[model samples]
Target: MAQTVGDFLVERLYAWGVRKIFGYPGDGINDVFGALNRAGGKIEFIQARHEEMAAFMASAYAKFTGELGVCIATSGPGASHLVTGLYDARLDHMPVLAIAGQQARTALGGHYQQEVDLPSLFKDVAGAFVQQASAPAQVRHLVDRAVRIALGERRVTAIILPNDLQEEPYHEPGRKHGTLHSGIGYSRPKTVPYDADLHRAAEILNSGRKVAMLVGAGSLGATDAVIAVADKLGAGIAKALLGKAAVPDDLPYVTGSIGLLGTEPSYTMMMECDTLLMVGSGFPYSEFLPKEGQARGVQIDLAPDMLSLRYPMEANLVGDAAETLRALLPLIEQKTEKSWRADIEKNVADWWKTLEERAIQPAVPVNPQRVTWELSPRLPDGVILTSDSGSCANWYARDLRIRRGMMASLSGGLASMGAAVPYAIAAKFAHPDRPVIALVGDGAMQMNNMAELITVAKYWRQWPDKRWIVCVFNNEDLNQVTWEQRVMEGDPKFDASQQIPNVPYHRFAELIGLKGIYVDRPQAVGPAWEDALAADRPVVLEVKTDPEVPPLPPHITFQQAMNFSRTLIKGDPREGGVIRETARQVLGAILPGGRGD
Candidate 1:
């Protein structure tokens, strides 16, 4: 019997190491889905509530597995909705393949039920795009090309399949697309090291009295080089939010993160440093930049384009970070005294002490930041923590620690919501032995496919520890959105009060066959958390939280502080006084009780 096109695509995907594919079925792609199901346990079909979630999950999977993660959508709105996740995959350099259904070949260009130009719609988001040209042979070639582009290029791939194409008879055997190759030919430019330039940079480091090293996401693979540079230069190391995992926080040279929402040590280091070394990071927040115009700085990156893009550079090294650092190692003269290093370490230690105290102080309607901090200490080493954008983003950015050997990934620049579940699913699938957990706000989780609980449950049936754990800090409202609203409109009344009602998220999980635990009491959080972790299956730990509590990122803008103050002072002192007092309790402990300008 001749194999069908549908059967061939499934075989190709299975060969590509895809254990599961997530999507919503439509009549146009029904034959393909049927073929996948008939493949019988080789490739599992995961049904998501929305195509967007499927895309997000697939993108996360690709990131975790370092292979092409595939998501299927049934054309039109389904394909359109996938744009968000595809954009994320592109920005983060994830490998994802979007297999979308199209109108029948005969109805091409006509406004059938779900017809749209796949190539045009996906132009910006996808690294490669193709349409199955109504021929089985073409479909076979395009699928192979897509897999190559997605995996090798490390970008999103979009393939549009018409109804007729999926049903077409196939003669040739399907072959898996080879991995896509990206950035291979772009050799690091050679650096003609000027002895004078090195001498000048070294002089700045020696003469500045105090210097700090700021690293960013682009420096991820060059840790040893960064540490050597920092040590040789007697520089304290600080990271942008995206670069937090580059160096272990416990290092004496480490001073935590810097940004609009940064920790105290980073803020202090950023302001106090007489000289700065910008390493492979494009930190977007210029507000956190040093005020001194004449402050000497050196920027080093493999990509020449990224250097000096954020700030002026005194010296630029356009080479791989490790190679550059190796070159500079011998040139750098070691410092004699440890006074500056000791001072920076002391400052960081003091700041952490204060933060720890603030995190533990008792209060009703628990502080979200405090809860997140406490939770972080309890997480097992190497646990993959995926955070959604919103207030939770602030918490995860500031508090979450990526222990050594742990893989931490987030939508740093293109930060978006609804990535938590997908990230956890992907993490679990990639590292079946490691624990994978997602921390999401109620609002962000709802936008993506929270229904992915089905996929997690299925995986859990195979392996229990790999069971995805979703810990939702459900505030019954979009607190992050409301906070932004308050900042923009200066009106607390303009909140997500209408969008969120008390939904029994835990009960909803139970109905789907996973363990569901709801924690309204702060005291119940620990036990519930432990139980959820020990559960033999996928679990949802829905934590009811205070919507009004803001994540304190230490370096909040002055305007934001004023708005917060106004919100507190304008309301009745009795109820609102509690919030004001809470704010004072946290912020007052820091410098001046004022905000970053």
Candidate 2:
């Protein structure tokens, strides 16, 4: 008796050591899911509330385990839902194989139910998009190729299986392809060492009056090399937000993230530097980089395509970061006595002073940024934090200090709202024993598939002792959008108080069997968080905040200056009263530290 192609595909998944598959089963892919079920304990299918969450969970699994994470979707809408996670995987260079179910081969291009061009939709995001042919051998080959592309290239790959093709009888001997390996063992490329180029970099470092290192995500595997390079050159190191853990942030030589949410010290150093050595970082904000004649930019990257795209580069070295950095360390003479490092350290001190001033001065119904920054340090070490899109994402990126082995993942490019719940579930799933907390906004959470909270509840039921907390900064409005509109259009009508219907977030939390704590006062948040984290299962801490608080990007902005002056002129009138109260509490905390320069 011949087997179905779907059955053969399940066997291949088992052969490749994929023990679990995360997805939703639908009419389009019922045959495959059924085959997955019949395969018994060899492979388990974990159903997700939304296809996107399944993709995100699978993406995180790929990122953490270095294996091919798998997710599935049915035709049309189902496939469309998976695109966001696929984009996230593509941008982060994660390995994932998304098996999307297409309409039957006969109805593929015709006007049939849920029929759409799967290959065309997925072309831009996938490393390889395969449409399985009628032959079982073709199905086998496509699966193998997808798995290889995903695992080998660290990219998202897709394979579409037609309904009839999946159910069709298999005729060929299902020859198993080689299992994918997920280790970083890149073969050394043929190379002639650029002696003069290496020496020029060394000479520049040796001769520079002030040198600053800007690190990026590509330096993840080579952090030690970056640290050594910084130490050798007496250079202060700053990082892109994604590269927070690339170097120890608390190090005296280290400042903060450099971009729109960057610190004064970091921005100052970039402006003051004689030489800016970019190691394995691709900073998207070109404005943060010093214009020519102010500082010279030298970039080192493994990918030739990304070289000098953000800033005009004086030199580009294509090589392994660790090897190249190590080689340069020996050739470069130690800076005997550079005052630039001291100046950077002093600037960092000044920046911290400004942050302290802003934080210590508190008011009633406190600013969300102040509360977030204040509350972050209170969380336990190794606590996993997942942030939602909007201003909260920027706040956490600027304020939180990540320790080693601690995980923080967010939407890189798509910046999707409601990412917090799914991302938190995945983080907790990946690190079951640790405390997982997701910081989300009430408005944004509404957009996410909330039924996934049932999965969170189910996972909590399965493991009752775990601590998975969701902190909702319930401002009762889309405050980030309001602020952005204010910045872009000077629109006073965009204020959150003018629009939005109230949704009781705490009641929603109870619907999912999670404990809910509601804080009307800003001072109540810290203890509420501590209590929530002490609970056995997942808890939601709803913090009521002022929606009109000044937007706190790192730089002291013209918008902020204008807003503050306007507020002062208006005498900071009280409507909601909570808004001013909140600002006052935060301002009180900041008053002792003195003003920002």
Best-matching candidate per TM-score: 2
lDDT of 2 at 73: 83
- Kindly list the per-residue Cα lDDT of model 1 for residues 13-116, writing each as its tens digit: 77667787877888768778878877888997766767877777787777566567888988788889888877888776677888888888889877777788
Model 2 residue 441 CA deviation (Å) reads 1.7
Q: Model 1: residues >4 Å from true position, as ranges?
A: 3-20, 30-46, 127-153, 169-209, 291-305, 314-333, 464-467, 487-489, 493-499, 569-575, 586-597
Clashing pairs in 1: 148-180, 152-180, 152-181, 153-180
Residues 1-597 of candidate 2 have per-residue lDDT tens digits of 467888888988777778767788887887888788778768867678899888887876665555678899887899889988888788777778898888888886689989888888888889455555555667766777778767666688888888888898865544467423232222235332387878877777777778888987666667788988888788998887656667755677788788766777788888778888998776787778777777776778766777888877777777667778887889877786768888888888776666656554454465576656666667677777777877676667666666666666666556677777777777665666778878887777676645677788776875534788877777766767765544444444334353556667777779878888888765676778778878877887777766666444445445544554354444532334554443343343333342423
Alpha-carbon TM-score of each model against the true structure: 0.84, 0.87
Q: Residue 219 in model 1: shift from native, Å? A: 3.8
What's the true lDDT of residue 178 in model 2? 42
RMSD of each: 4.9, 4.6
